[model samples]
Target: PGRGRRAGSRRVYGTLEDLLGGDIFSDFFRTFFGDFERAAGRRPGRRAEQELEVTLADAYTGAVKPYDIIGPDGRAHRVEVRIPPGVRDGDVVRVTVPGLGDLSFRAKVRPDPQFERKGDDLYVEVPVKLTTCILGGEVEVPTSTGKLILKIPPGTQNGQVFRLRGQGMPRPENPSQRGDLYARVRVVLPTRLTDRQRALFEELARLETAETYAGAR
Candidate 1:
């Protein structure tokens, strides 16, 4: 009877791995869980937000809310995603959700003008027609022998443009013609950085100043 009890107890008291089911979904396997949130909180002399959420969406894309991550302290946080710009009907977008994962989906951008900000924090409204083709898809170029792929980098800016000759909209009077594609670029900086990293950066600045002083002579 004692032997049977021992076996039952062993089975009941499984390892932490067993409780979590698998390594892929386990805490150890995650790249960044609350790292960003925690870092944000620590820097500003406050706790990382216990309850936080960000929502991104559009009328056509509907609502997409990724899985919420629970901190060790039992706080729930979720990230909300808005529909991507420039995707017409049947177009696909690669959505990245930290901690939870990434996914792709099909959606469309409304024909109405959309307003968004640039890296400099300037806001601008862009017409749908000018941005329709470049959203979520790469522009392809044809050479004499084969083809070339041109990818537009993320965080594109306003008024900046990419010129792909003969890639523009077809003219009504010219059936054999097409228009070029122009894409803008946007750059973003994280709101904060680690203390160690900031110290290193400051050291670099000092070094650069020393070099400049030496060159002046």
Candidate 2:
């Protein structure tokens, strides 16, 4: 569309005109030939890929999302892309740019605040009170959809992990089957023990000591 000139400075980005050289008319012919070759089932060169960042939710369920990209003119331009379901981080997705060929987009899936993904599995840490760990109780756990109650067995140790089947991310190609979710326990210690609490713990400690002595004997 415009005349081409020698580079006065390094170009940050440009259209086919920057790469093809000469005026828009010349570049138009070059693009025409390139598209023609592509349609004929041949590639002219290596395809270029642009990085796109998408929300975790969008990547999880797949959606047509609008994103802004900086153009060669240094202005933000809005473009829409169809994100496939179960698109993991660094996965590339094809994009259709008008009059442009041999280009794609690589998706950067944002991290979820509550869940950490490994392959298809998900992991989350839940805080369990000391009393709950010792006496057994139910604690609320965070999941993709909502909260669920996780039963803690008596004598549950800190850092223990519990697995919930079919609660993790869905398979990329299959939505019916899903991975597992792991909840790691983080025991919360009691602070500023009261007189009765301290006495009870002291008695428990003595009892454990007596048991150990009897075992040794």
Candidate 3:
């Protein structure tokens, strides 16, 4: 019933006691236990380490979609924006680059504007869900400057909102119900960085003697 060796016997030494007493078996067990001990000492997993499932089903009208940012895993990420009054394709939405994060450039998704005007009312279909390339990436943008950059830190959140000042246009008739551009920061870790880049980062970390921006409670 056994393939050359029995459960209670040792194939190499012919007996359990003989195998246990051998130098090779003793060395093997010592090495195995040592590695296991080191592995068991690591920190446990937390909610932040979990993977999130996101979906986008319905198509958006009058929304802008810039070039998708590819994560380290080679996947494109899209951010949804409401088609504010008078927004069209190729219009760059100024976004502030978040500290420790990168900025997202959202371009118009639809080729033609999709808004209906009825008497004194105007309506447009907006995106139900917006995606960000980096998670927890909060942007500080200046719309008037016509220069925006998004800097997403290492840990951004999904569905977190960001606003652009004066970027929204006045409603067609009301002039008060103006629409604003919003973005959600998506977090993604790099699959891997090159050795040279890693070394540079390690060096930069070593040079930091003081805490620069650890938020104060």
Candidate 4:
């Protein structure tokens, strides 16, 4: 009778071990955890944000960029990002990946040396020769598209602003519409003057004084 009792105890212990170490236990825990998460209104994954730096030209022309991000499993993933035209700085782009939560990209536009942007307008300083400022002529001006020859009016003063329509940055909302470009004139004076040039200026100064002061006191 004792031997039978010992055999029954061993059988009960073996069954308990099998129950604890089998797929049934795993399924039970998974269901419990899933139900708990649903009841708590929580998700199982995380979201990530990253920053991408782009040039002003790229923002104007649009481009395909690539990025690498770290995954939850400590692995690296390469992602290709499609950038649209007319994306301003501080714009946020969202991308979704399968099995992963939403990924956000914050855009940062780099500064350009030739132009200063304000809203949709672009400002540039174009140097004009002193002779061109005094005498009307054409000067080469740089634009987003290409170089343009701009006519300078006679006696154009330094710091004078000239507006070129439809030559500025594209509007972010509507890329087909563009803003204006303002080009400020910067007069470049002659540093070294020849003897004949100095003599001619002196003669002109004397003539100016006599012609203007002859009628005055």
Q: For this target, which candidate reaches the highest TM-score against the unseen true structure?
A: 4
- How does residue 101 of candidate 3 score in lDDT? 28
Cα lDDT of model 3 by residue, 160-180, tens digit: 445533334444345455445
Assess the local accuracy of residue 80 in candidate 4 as a C-alpha lDDT between 0 and 100.
Answer: 66
Candidate achieving higher lDDT, 1 or 4: 4
Query: Model 4 clash pairs?
Result: none
**Lowest-sum lDDT 10-residue window in model 2:** 4-13
For residues 85-195, write the lDDT of model 4, one tens digit per residue: 778888877777655445566677778999888877889999999999988898999987688889999978888899999888788788898888899999998888899
Top candidate when judged by lDDT against the true structure: 2
Task: Report the error of model 3 at residue 167, Å.
Answer: 5.1
Backbone clash numbers for all candidates listed: 14, 1, 28, 0
TM-score of each: 0.24, 0.68, 0.24, 0.70
**Candidate 2 vs 4: which has more lDDT:** 2
Q: Tell me how candidate 1 scores on lDDT.
A: 0.37
List, residue by residue over 9-40, the lDDT tens digit for candidate 1.
Answer: 22111233343342323332232354655544
Off by over 4 Å in 4: 1-48, 207-217
Clashing pairs in 2: 1-24
Deviating ranges (above 4 Å) for candidate 2: 1-46, 68-77, 101-103, 209-217
Two-way lDDT contest, 1 vs 3, winner: 1
Native-structure RMSD, model 3: 27.8
